[model samples]
Target: MMRLVASDIDGTILGHDGRISARTVRAFQACADAGVEVVFVTGRPPRWLYPLREQLGHSGTVICSNGAVLWDLAEDRLLSARAIGLEAVLEARRLIKQLCPDALFAAETVAGFHLEPGFIENPTSELLAEFTPAPLHETLTAEDAVVKFLAVTHSGTPDAFLAQVQPVVAHLVETTHSAPRTALLEMSAPGVNKAVTLAAYAASLGIEAADVVAFGDMPNDIEMLRWAGHGYAMASGHPEALTAAGYQAPHFDDDGVAQVIEARLAEEKLGA
Candidate 1:
């Protein structure tokens, strides 16, 4: 039996309007009523998760920054945070500057976002928390270790930018993105992807991968979908996610996540 549901935030649950639908909320509430845990696994930062906690009725865990941080939503406290050391940050910054000179950068710490003024926000993207803007040098050397680093370029396609940056920094960090079309690149600590983190958390609860179902719609979600026992990609998801997942759901705007969850709940009810 599927005991857990791990889902991505932006493209999987949040609609193009940038809000979670009532149908999605009801589906999750149903999961909770059934004693099935629903966890959010996403590339979003901790600061972006509080609103979701309210939507999900303040239940479950949230793996944010592509798995670099885990928040126990029920308790309203942090569970764990994985950070990239300054050395790695310095190395990554060096490579990013070398490969994409015009790239803008930001870092998501456990506290909040620290960004340079150059990093533009997608109009459709979630409104960011108050940010600390610093010079490139200070931004790279910020006191606290960062959970994830972000890079944006106006020059080329995201895939092309990633192709140029990956080989240089792969050894130092894990690389992926929730928005590939925007030429955004997200770097997390080495070995910290949604799959590894979610699997670890599930194992802690005596649940195995086979007992979990995950959903996603971006390249950042690739490892997560691959790691779950049953993974569903949104029909309107990125092409790479479609290739990575075994099943597909409807679009986020159409309440795809709720549809799938309701179906699974029906099956469980019949089985019972």
Candidate 2:
């Protein structure tokens, strides 16, 4: 019943170590070989996605930055993108100077992340290992654009900052709690999400939303999975993600995504 398939990287397709398993790669290869349009959707920046693209070995498309950018994997280029207007964006740097003076702001661009020295220490740097950055002044008047801006406090109390800023920025942006210690504020742009990206692809191929299967395991993945014809939540996923999904896969460590794909491919063969 499904022709188009989309998957979230983190807990859905990528392993706990932030890599896709050989088994999972082969499974997705079979799907691509079977003419299923496989799309990798993630909240990661494009630079981080380059390594994943090589690892997946699939010649399809990618929806990066949680759909802020659409990349063409086969062509090795960006096809479409939606970046936050720096003018309308939350002044996380300004907020840091006022509320948490010791807090450091890191901005993600198409190139990589940039921040002031001593901004990212051991624990925080380890979490965002790939997005190391340069520094920003009161106003970052640069050529490259910023995808996302993050505030990492030296005090390790992200909630303290969120409590003070979320209400103030609520009217101007969209906020997501990726982790209790990490708050992501995505600029508002209607119809910009993994679901929308996949949906548009499905429509272009004459495949309705009813003929698609999707999988995910994060709060950022909610819309993507729910938009699929057969949506699944990883067993090791968050409670909110499980509630939003139609069924449960095994777990990332258990190769749940590969199992689901194999089963569906078998069903498709049988139907054929």
Candidate 3:
């Protein structure tokens, strides 16, 4: 029997309009009521999760920052974090700069998002209000724990950019991107990705990968998808995710994740 349901938030469950469908919400609550653990695993920073607190309606654990941080949603507290050391961050930056001098940098920490000037253009008023603009090196001190590092460039498509940088930085950090067309790359500490953290978390609960059902729609979700026993890729998901997952679900816009969850619950009920 499945004991855990791990899902990616953005393209897997969350709609383009930034809302979770009623069907999806009910499916998640049903999992909880059935004594199954539902985990929202995403590349989002901890600060961006508050808006989702009410939407999800349960104070469960969120594996954010591509598995760099574990957040307790109910208490609005950080449970644990796997941060990139300052030297590693600087080294990776140096390596990437050598490959793409036009690359802009940003860092996410437990405190908030910090970016260098011009890292993002036409910043929304909300972003301008929330994000601190300062030189990344100056803003991130040796004492601060960096959760994730971001690099963006207007030079190439997101895939091409990742291809160019992955080889250069592979020895230094784990690199991936969620947005298919956006020329951005997200990096965490070496060997730190969704699967590694998710496995550890599940083990703590005495749950094995074979007892978990995972869903995702992006390259960032590949590791976790492959790690879970039953992994479903959204029909509209990136090519990499489709190839990584063993099964495919309907499109996210069509409530794909919810459809699968409801079907599984029905199967379980019938078997019982």
Candidate 4:
């Protein structure tokens, strides 16, 4: 029986209007009512998770920044943070500049976002409402630790960008795309991903990989999906996620996650 539900936020659960539907909300409530731990695992930063916290009634752990931080949403406190070392951050910035000169960059510092003018926010992001813009040079030289770095392109696809930078920096840092269509590429420290943090959280709760069910629609979710025993890729999911998941669910706008969650709840009720 599944004991945990790890879900990606932007595409896996939220509706097109960037809010939770009643159906999805009910699914989460059912999970809680059934004593199953619910985790929002995503590439979204902590600031962006506030609305979600309110939607879920602020009662669970959120693995944010693609696994760089674990937040106790109910208490509205940060439990732990894993930042990329200064040396690695500098090295990755240097390599990206040399290979992709025109790429715009942003870093998620412990406090908040330090972004350049060229960087664009996802239409669904709430963090930008209070973010501060800094020069790329100034941002990269900050004394604060960086949780994640984003490379955004004014032109070109994320796949092309990923291919161009993988060989040069993959060994030095971890890289993946959160948004499938945009040229937004996300980077975390070596060996960091949703899977790493989620697995650790599960172990702490005495839940194994076989007892977790995860959902996603982007490349960043690929690792987490693969790590879960029953990974469901959205019908409109990215190619990488589709390849990584063991099964397929309906589309996000169609309440695909709710469909799956409600089904699981029913099975539990029936002892199936």
Question: Candidate 4, clashing residue pairs?
Answer: none
lDDT of 2 by residue, 1-272 (tens): 76877888876776546687889988988987898888787877666675566787666678877777787777878787765556545464565467667666656666556665665676466535654445665435555566665666656544455666666555544444344344433333334667877788778889988888889887667787788889898998877788989878988788999999999999989999
Per-model TM-score on C-alpha atoms: 0.92, 0.81, 0.97, 0.93
RMSD after CA superposition, every candidate: 2.3, 3.6, 1.1, 2.3
The regions of model 4 sitting more than 4 angstroms off are 121-129, 140-142
- Kindly list the per-residue Cα lDDT of model 1 for residues 1-272, writing each as its tens digit: 87999999887887657678889889988898899987898888766776686666656688988999998777777899999887887779878988878988888777667777668655334443355467656755657769998889987887887888988999999988777468989999999999999999999999999889999999888888888888999999989999999888888778998999999999988999
User: lDDT for every model?
Assistant: 0.84, 0.70, 0.90, 0.85
Enumerate residue pairs that collide in model 3. none
Model number with the top lDDT: 3
Residue-level lDDT tens digits of model 3 in 84-139: 99888888898998999999999888877888888888777577677768888788
Over 141-171, each residue of candidate 4 has an lDDT whose tens digit, in order, gives 5477788988887778888998888778886
Worst lDDT run of 10 residues, candidate 4, spans 120-129
Ranking under TM-score, best-scoring first? 3, 4, 1, 2
TM-score of 2: 0.81
Report the poorest 10 consecutive residues by lDDT, candidate 2. 180-189
Q: Judged by lDDT relative to the true structure, which candidate is superior, 1 or 2?
A: 1
> What is the clash count of model 1?
0
